[model samples]
Target: MSEQDFLRRLPEAGHSLRRRDRLQHRLHLDFTLLLLLALVAGYGLIVLYSANGQSMDGVQRQGIYFALAFAVMFVTAQVPPHLLRRLAPWAYAAGVALLVLVLVLGIGAKGAQRWLGIAGFRFQPSEVMKLAIPIMIAAYLGRRLMPPSLKHIVVSLALVLLPTVLIMLQPDLGTSLLVASSGLVVLFFAGLSWRYLLVAGVVIVASVWPLWQFVMHDYQKQRVLTLLDPEKDSLGSGWNIIQSKTAIGSGGYSGKGWLEGTQSQLDFLPEGHTDFIIAVLGEEFGFLGVMVLLALYCLIIARGLLIALRAQDSFSRLLAASITFTLFVYVFVNAGMVAGMLPVVGVPLPLVSQGGTAIVTLMAGFGLLMSIATERRRVSR
Candidate 1:
C-alpha cells in the first residue's frame, strides 16, 4: 500500500480500535451487578452523611473508598477465573502468613490485637482470610470430587478451623466467624453430605459451652450476656444495643428525614457511621429505606448465585457461592445486631458500612463473580 493510502486507513483503524475497546469494556464489566453495587454504595453515602452528624467528612472519605474499590474490582475482573484458581493457594498462604505476622507484631484498638501496622498503615489480616479461605477450599476441592468425600471434608474443615482459631485468638470474634462461615459455605456448595452437616450442627451445639467458657474472652462473653439482657447494664456494655434498638424503633415506618435522626444527631447511637449505620438508616430513612436497602442486597445476592449456577467450572461455582453467602452473613449480622436480635460482633454492613478494607475485598469478590459470568469456554477443533 502507498504511504498516502496507509494514512487514509489510519482513521478507519482508529475507529475500529475504539469500537473494539467499547466492546471489550462492555464484555468485561457486569452491568447488572455493577448497577446494584452502585445503588447500595450510593445509598450508603447518603445514610453515612446523615449518620456522621450531617458532616461531609465521612461521605467524602467513603466516596474515595468506593472509587478505590471499583478500581480494584475492575482490575480483578480482568483476571480470568483460571488464573484465580491457580493463584488461590498462594493467596491463602499469604493471608495466613499475614495473620501470623499480625499476632507477632500486632496493633490494638479498644482491646483486641487484630491489625498489622505497616509503615503507618493499619490493616486487619483477618479480612483477607474471609476471601482467601473460601478461594483455597474451592481450588482444593473443585479439582477433586463432588460432595467432597469424608477425607476431603476433614481437610476442608481443617483449612477453615485453622484460620478461624487464629482469628479468634486475635480476639476478633466477628471476623473469625465470617472467615469460618466463608470456608463452610464453600464446603456446603461443594456438596458436603447432609449427614455431615447435621453432625456438624450437633457438634456446634455441644461446643457452645466450651466456646463460651474456654474460647471466648471476657468482653466477648459480656457481649453475649448483654445480648441476653441489654437492660441489665444499660449504662455500661449494654448502652450500644439499647441506643441502637431505640434508633431503629424510633424510625417507625417513614423515617425522620435525612440528617434529622435524633438518636444519631444527639449521639445517642454509637458507631452510627460504621457498624450501627443501619440503625441510622432505620432512624432517618425509616423502615421503608431499610427495605429498599435490603432489596438491593437481595438482587446482588441473586445475581451472584445465578452467576455461580452458570459457572463453567466447580471452582467458579464454589467461590461465587461462598462469596455470595458471606455477603448474606454480613448483612444479616449487622442488621440483626443493630436490631438487638443478635450479639454485637462488629460486623460492618456489606458495601454500605464505612470501611476501606471491607469495601475493597467485597468489590473484588463481585469482580470475580463478573469474571465467572462473562468467561467463555474455549473450544478447539
Candidate 2:
C-alpha cells in the first residue's frame, strides 16, 4: 500500500473509534440499574403529586428534587471509589459535627429538633449521619484485619451509639434506627456470625421493655400500643394506623387507580404525602403495583450488594453494603407501618416521601453506590 493510501484511511479509523466510544458509554450504564431508579422515582412522583395535588409548589419542589438527585448521581459516578475512601472520614466528622449543632441549636418540626436552619433553608444533620456513618465504618473496617476484633466491634458500636443517642435525644427514633441499621450492615457484611446476630436481636427485644418504661415519652408509648391495637384508638392516636391499613386493603387487587385514592384526595389519611406515602401507592396501584415497586426496590438493593461484593477494597465493599441496608430499612419499615405490623414512627417511603432532606440523603447514598458501580469490578482489575 502507498503512504498516501494509508493516510487517507486514518480518518475512517478515527471515526470508527469515536463510534466505539459512544457505544461503550451506553453499554456501561447497566440498564437494570436505570430501570430500577426510573420506576421508583416515577411512581414516587406520581404518589407525591396525588398526596399534594392542592399545592403546585410541592409538586415543583419534588420535580426539582428528582432532577437534583439524578445530577448528584451522575457526579458521584465520575468519582473513583478509592477517592471516596479518602473522603469518608472528613465526611463522617462533618456529619457528626452537624448532628451536634442540631442538638445545640436546631429547628423543630412536629415536636422534634432535627433540622438546622441554613441560609433560610432547613437541613437535617441526622440525614448526614445516615450517609456518613456507613462510609466511615467502611473506611475504618476496610483498613483492619478481616473479621474485626472485639475492640473493633465495640468501637463500631460506639460509632453507631454516639449518633443514635444524639438523634434519640432529638427524639427522632426513625432516623436513629435507620442510621444504626446502616452501620450494622457494614459489620454484618464484614462477616458477622449468625450467633452474634441472634444475640443482637435478643438484646434489642429485651431492651425494648426498659426503653419503653424508662426512656419513651408518653406519646411514644402510645405509638407502640397503637401498633398492637390500632382499632382501640381509632379516633385518636390509632387513627393514622387505621386509615393506613384501610388504604392498603382498599387498594385490593388493582387499587382505586392514580389520583383516585379516596383516602388521600379526600384527606381521610393523615400525612398521606409524607410518612403515609406508601398507603397512597398501595391504595391507588393495588397489589400488582406494590409488587412491582417492591421488585424495583429489590433490584436496587441487590445491585447495591453486588457493587459491594465487586468492590476493590474492604471499605468500599462495606460502604456499598451499608447503602443497600439503608435503602432496605426505608422499604421495610414503611411497608411494615402501612401493613399495620409496626408502629407508625414517621418513616417515609424513600423517593416517595415529600421531605427535601430525606430525599436528598437517600439520593446521596445512591450516589455512593454509583461511585462503587462505576469503578472497575475487582481489586485485581
Task: Give the per-residue lDDT of model 1 (tens digit) for 174-231.
Answer: 9899999999999888877789989999999999999888888888899999999999
**Top TM-score prediction, candidate number:** 1
Q: Return the lDDT, model 2, position 221.
A: 86
Q: Give a tens-digit lDDT track for model 2, residues 1-381.
A: 999999999999999987764553333344456668878888888778888956777788888888887776666666677887899889988888888998899998788898898798887888888888888888888999978887888899898888888889998887888888889888988887678789899999999889988989888888888899888979999889889889999999999988898998899999898888888888999998889889889989899888788877788788888888888899999999878898877788888788787877787677767667656632334
Tell how far residue 191 is off in model 2, in angstroms: 0.7
Per-candidate Cα lDDT values, in order, are 0.89, 0.83
Worst 10 residues of 1 by lDDT: 372-381
Choose the strongest candidate by lDDT.
1
The 10-residue segment of model 2 with minimum total lDDT is 22-31
Which regions of candidate 1 fall more than 4 Å away from where they truly are?
Answer: 1-27, 377-381
Give per-residue lDDT, candidate 2, residue 362: 82
Off by over 4 Å in 2: 1-31, 377-381
